[model samples]
Target: MAAQLREILLRTRRHLLLARPGEQPSRLAGEGLDFRELREYTLDDDIRHLNWKSMARIRKPLVNRYNESRQISVGLVYLNSGSLAIGAPVSKKDLAVELLTALSYAAARSGERVSTWFLGADECAYYPPGRRQGDLAERNHALATALEAKGEPADSEQLLRELGPRLRRRSVLFLLGDFMKPLDLSALASRHEIHALILRDRLDEELPGGSFLLEDTGSLRRKEAVIDPAAREHYRRLVREQDAALFEHFRRHGIGWEKFGTSQEPIARLAQYLRRP
Candidate 1:
């Protein structure tokens, strides 16, 4: 079931990427180089890219409006610590990849340069951002291969901490993970705009009363523990609380952000975000 969700995320993001109208600006700035359309000459025009030949043809002046070329630097970074193996509809780890894929496709669709980085248990991989569709495909393949080749979870917090200091540019940075491990967002917030994707598996969603055996993904560790409804309820409450607090912090700092679950239709959310006024 979780596997199917992963496939859906991949397909939906790709579709959105390909279907974007070439005339739309990547964001509110509208300073991109994409050619949008033409309009009658106005006093406040750039006065360049002006069709002088068209003026002779129409015997009138018209202004050429251009949609911004996708120039925003959007980076997708996913954390692959062992703790993400905890969900059902989508394991936290797979969902991380899916989120990265969705965001990458969306950025590319907007002509925003899309780069990707995968910090797995033992390795770190980087894929350069590019405007062509092929770049995303290559990045997706790399993400899949990295997810499959595993050893043990790496220090996710450490990864974020390191990223924070080096990135002083205004790029969109997404950090996908389950906060089962702690992170220093305050440090990251200083350098990059960080949006956190918090993932929770369906199994982690509900807890049945009584003792039950549970299995871990990579480790396959077994545990026979009593299901205290209160404990599960507490877990759910804490997750909600933390999610709100995390976004709140980003908001307070004037950092751009959005959060979604593994079950949500990521395309709609992304389209709405990218197509904002």
Candidate 2:
């Protein structure tokens, strides 16, 4: 079933790729296959792409057929915090993986390289950019495997410290996390175009009525509680406060923010978000 969903996700929403401007010709963008005819050199053309042989033969400065040169790097960073395992219709972790797959595939289809970072409690796992056409599936597979190995709350501060220096300046970064832990994104915000995807569960925010014992997925600790009106209201207020703070931080840093619910269709929501001006 999971494999089927994966294949369907890969095939669906291909139209979004067409909307992407990555295919546009740019003298700074990297060269792609299927060379076009060479033309007279222009001031805007990069000298590195110049065809020295053609210039010598024609006695005129000419550039090669490879005109496109800008290689936009698209990166997805996932927070492997234990809170993400909570699920109502879908697990936050599962939805995150799906969203990453969709984003990576869309970027790859648009001729951009896709990279992923899975930040866990004990350690962080990095997947290098898969620029080649066939590597997308492998990258997604690796991401799926990493998502399955979730643990305690990830060390967001430490992970960011390690990751910031490695990323290319102005690269597009998509951050997926439950946002239970406060993150210091100052360095990342200054260097990268950040898209923050906050994963949440409806069950977590709105407590259901009745007395039940709930166990923490990661710690294996149990707590019995009654979900009275006051308790429910308190939970709602706390959630709102957290969200407000998170949104404020993102706004201050000029990062794009979107909330993904476990009940929502990950790809559709992301596609809609991308379509927004």
Using lDDT as the measure, which candidate wins? 2
Q: Which candidate tops TM-score? A: 2
RMSD of each: 7.2, 7.9
Candidate 2: C-alpha lDDT: 0.71
RMSD of 2: 7.9
For residue 33, model 2's alpha carbon misses the true position, in angstroms, by: 17
110-185 per-residue lDDT for model 1 (tens digits):
5667677777656777776576754584567455545752335546376764454445566777766665444556
lDDT of 1: 0.60
Model 2 TM-score is 0.76
* Backbone clashes, each candidate: 9, 7
Report the poorest 10 consecutive residues by lDDT, candidate 2: 20-29
Stretches > 4 Å off in candidate 2: 19-69
